[model samples]
Target: MLTQDSMPPSAKAIETAEDLSSIAFGFMASKALFAGLHVDIFSALADGPKSAEELAGAADIPINRIVMLTTALASVGLLTIGDDKKVQNSPAAQSFLSKQTKYDFGDYLRYQIDQQMYPFLLQLNAVMKGDLSDDAIASYRHWMADEEQASVYSESQHAGSLGPGRTLARKVDLATASTLLDVGGGTGAMTISLCREYPNLQATIIDFPNVTEIGWRFISEADLVDRVRYIPGNAVEVQWPGNQDAILMSYLMSGVPGDNVEELVHKAFDALAPGGKLMVHDFMVEEDRRGPALAALWQLQHMAFTPDAHSLSVGWLTQTGKRIGFDVDQVDNLIPAMTKLVVFSKPS
Candidate 1:
């Protein structure tokens, strides 16, 4: 029989069990956050504080539900419940959740991440068995079949990438990079961010025709049509324009088959000029794989959705990069973590 001494120490055992339990119930928190976003809680509370009754009426949900959700949101630090029983966006929420802010990412949560990944996870058993039917996570076909679906998903994802794009601009120094090739840059969010940072830097984004069309609008809206250009083509098959100062592949590595990743990096190397940089930003887990829980979970999702593709770690990135004749410059872990920027430089 497993007694207290044989099993484990009571406090340590209880804490470990509680941690595992938290992971299992993680979806509950995600759904709650989604629910708060569904009713546009941050936006509703933007101008000032809002009572549960007011939020319920605005969202067309019951006050009880709003109270519960608001309490959850408050716990997550997305909102602050005041002494008057009124709630308002926390400083973080005001910056990133309120639709009124330029950095608002509510749609990205509601549409791109939650709507896209949640369904596949629901069929975890089938996915793990590698029996996921085509329709479960149709990468290109779904967007190509319907134009509205393409536009909505593309724009929402653009919003999702925008924050990271902005962070990339501020964090990375691109003063000397005059020309850049953005491989599989969806909607030109990162390109726009980089161009805004360096007025003289010009970027060309290569994406599918449908995505490029949407990206064109964003580039034009940014009044950077002259600086940021889009070329419609497949990254792996298409001829990358030669003599580039830098090549950027963001969130693309985790989508393609792992076997093809090295070849793809070689293609970028061939396309770069001497002293050029290659920037790869994507979801990555650490070598240990035991921790960095968020990234590990993301890698698991790729097991379900992306065939033959999975997250790459910083160590793997550096190792693969060196084998391909490039220097590992720096690895950056951006805000909110998981997604990382791996910069590689071609010898001058």
Candidate 2:
């Protein structure tokens, strides 16, 4: 028998085993949450409170599973159920979990399920074998090509625009600025945001041809066609239509090889006009590479998916920027707690 002073060996071992088992089964909770979002359960509850039966009817989920799903989500703090057994969206869930909200992460969850989870699980063997299979390549190609539908891809690109677009408009002295180039600007989100923010800023986005088509559509939809230009070409191979006042390379470099990244940075340096600025926005690992868990995990994911890809520390990036003839300054964090922006300026 286990006592306060000493536990039996069997009891201790069983407790240890149970702890390990729970750790291993952690993904089950994630799958449950993903399934809930995939079915728009949170959105259904956004309008009003409902019981499990009503929620099942509204969300088209099986009646039997409704209670289990809602109870699980409630346990996870995503939903709330009163003593009366009425379930409603929690504050966090209402803000971001519901599809009806602008900040809804439902699409992002769906993208993770459809694009990443299964393939990653299935290709664990190939990944470990260090083989870049055809299927893997095809999946990557499809991911890049389907930005319009892939919420994570679109969200990553939009992340760059969300901060810099607002910051540049408010902080940067744009009246003197004439031309801006958005390198690897996916869907022209940054350009559109910038153009809308700064009337005088003429922006051009360079990306793959297929990606540029989506950018063009966004530009047209935002009525920014007059201010934004689309250049459909490879960012590395093309001569970066030089003499621009500023260059924005948002979330671009981390996906390419380190050498390619260095080369591209040099290319941007050569392309900038006198006194032009280059803005680089991407995940930056801490110098120690121990904390900031997201960056560490992202580095592994990038390596698994892209060729010779890895995130660089901000210290390394600043050093490289200085070496390439740019006066560098670390900009404020865009997403507050996530990533930092590095701003480099060419001499006048």
Candidate 3:
């Protein structure tokens, strides 16, 4: 009865299976992209089109390797091969992947996803076991403890957060709020964006000492040295500034252990003034917790590196806020790819 040929799958089922297989092979596509970034192939083609041989020469790789990689690149729409087989960037690649572009995020890919998170998959089983000593493996906590590692992590993460920061600035208004606190705001990218939008807003960012220096660098780069300040300590234990009208916890909850979330939420509520607003920006998914393939996949990917790195849903957040005596509002598609911003207000 269960023989393979005995029960033929429907067309829809067949298509679903094909899609699932594509998901299974998704790592190959990511690896191919990583390989291209590794060799700075997109930057090599930034000025104009080039033949495989030309790319090989510019990139200092063999022609055969260039041809192979370019073939894969074209498959993913990163590069386009002309009638004469000259390779050039697709619009998407040109804008975000090329090093010369203003909006280039190639470094984020190179350092964060390709370097840091990708290899964590290798220890998926070990991470699931949850037996590794804090110092034994490169857990999120372990890496954050290292100043050098924190620098790389902060810079790489900052690159990816720039676009979202601008979007979030547009979505959340801080015109009436003078003083704001940003907890776990590494490099203060979001704070910089918000401060630029609301010139009257003065903000303080709290993060590890390892990240505070870089956070100050970004704040200075935004020319908001007077408006933005830094607090170096553990977010949960830090003495929160009282009577704050606004507080931001961007990606903080998702990065910490799952069991810590409720306590963190309570801490935030207690820290805020009665009329203050608490904003949470992090990876989230639909109520049913399905789809948004990247967010879903990342929760599992994060499991390999952190104790509880799963995305939190807006509905869950809303109910959580209500349970803690606050009203909840949300703006979806803040990042579109992986982040949603939820706002909580403490009733006056």
Q: Over the stretch 263-322, how does candidate 2's per-residue lDDT look in tens digits?
A: 988999998899998888777765655535555555555666664565777778888899
Steric collisions counted per model: 0, 0, 0
Q: Which one wins by TM-score: 1 or 3? A: 3
lDDT of 1 by residue, 11-80 (tens): 2333677799887887888888888888889899889998999899988998888899999989877889
Quote each prediction's TM-score.
Answer: 0.89, 0.83, 0.91
Q: Compose the digit string of candidate 3's lDDT tens values, residues 1-348.
A: 112242223224336777998878988888989899999999998999999999999999999999999999899788899999999999999899998999999999999888888887787777778875665566555677888789888999999888888888999877888988999999988888888888889898898888898778888888898898899888877888778888999988777778777877888888888888898987776566654556666667766767555457767877888898988755556666566688888898
Better of 2 and 3 by lDDT: 3
Off by over 4 Å in 2: 1-24, 112-114, 121-125, 138-175
Question: In terms of TM-score, which candidate is strongest?
Answer: 3
Q: What is the C-alpha RMSD of each candidate to the true structure, in Å?
A: 6.4, 8.2, 6.4
- What is the TM-score ranking, best to worst? 3, 1, 2
TM-score of 2: 0.83
Q: Candidate 3: count the clashes.
A: 0
| Model 3 per-residue lDDT at 7 | 23
Q: Which 10 successive residues of model 2 have the least lDDT summed?
A: 1-10
Candidate 3 Cα outliers beyond 4 Å, as residue runs = 1-17, 129-137, 309-311
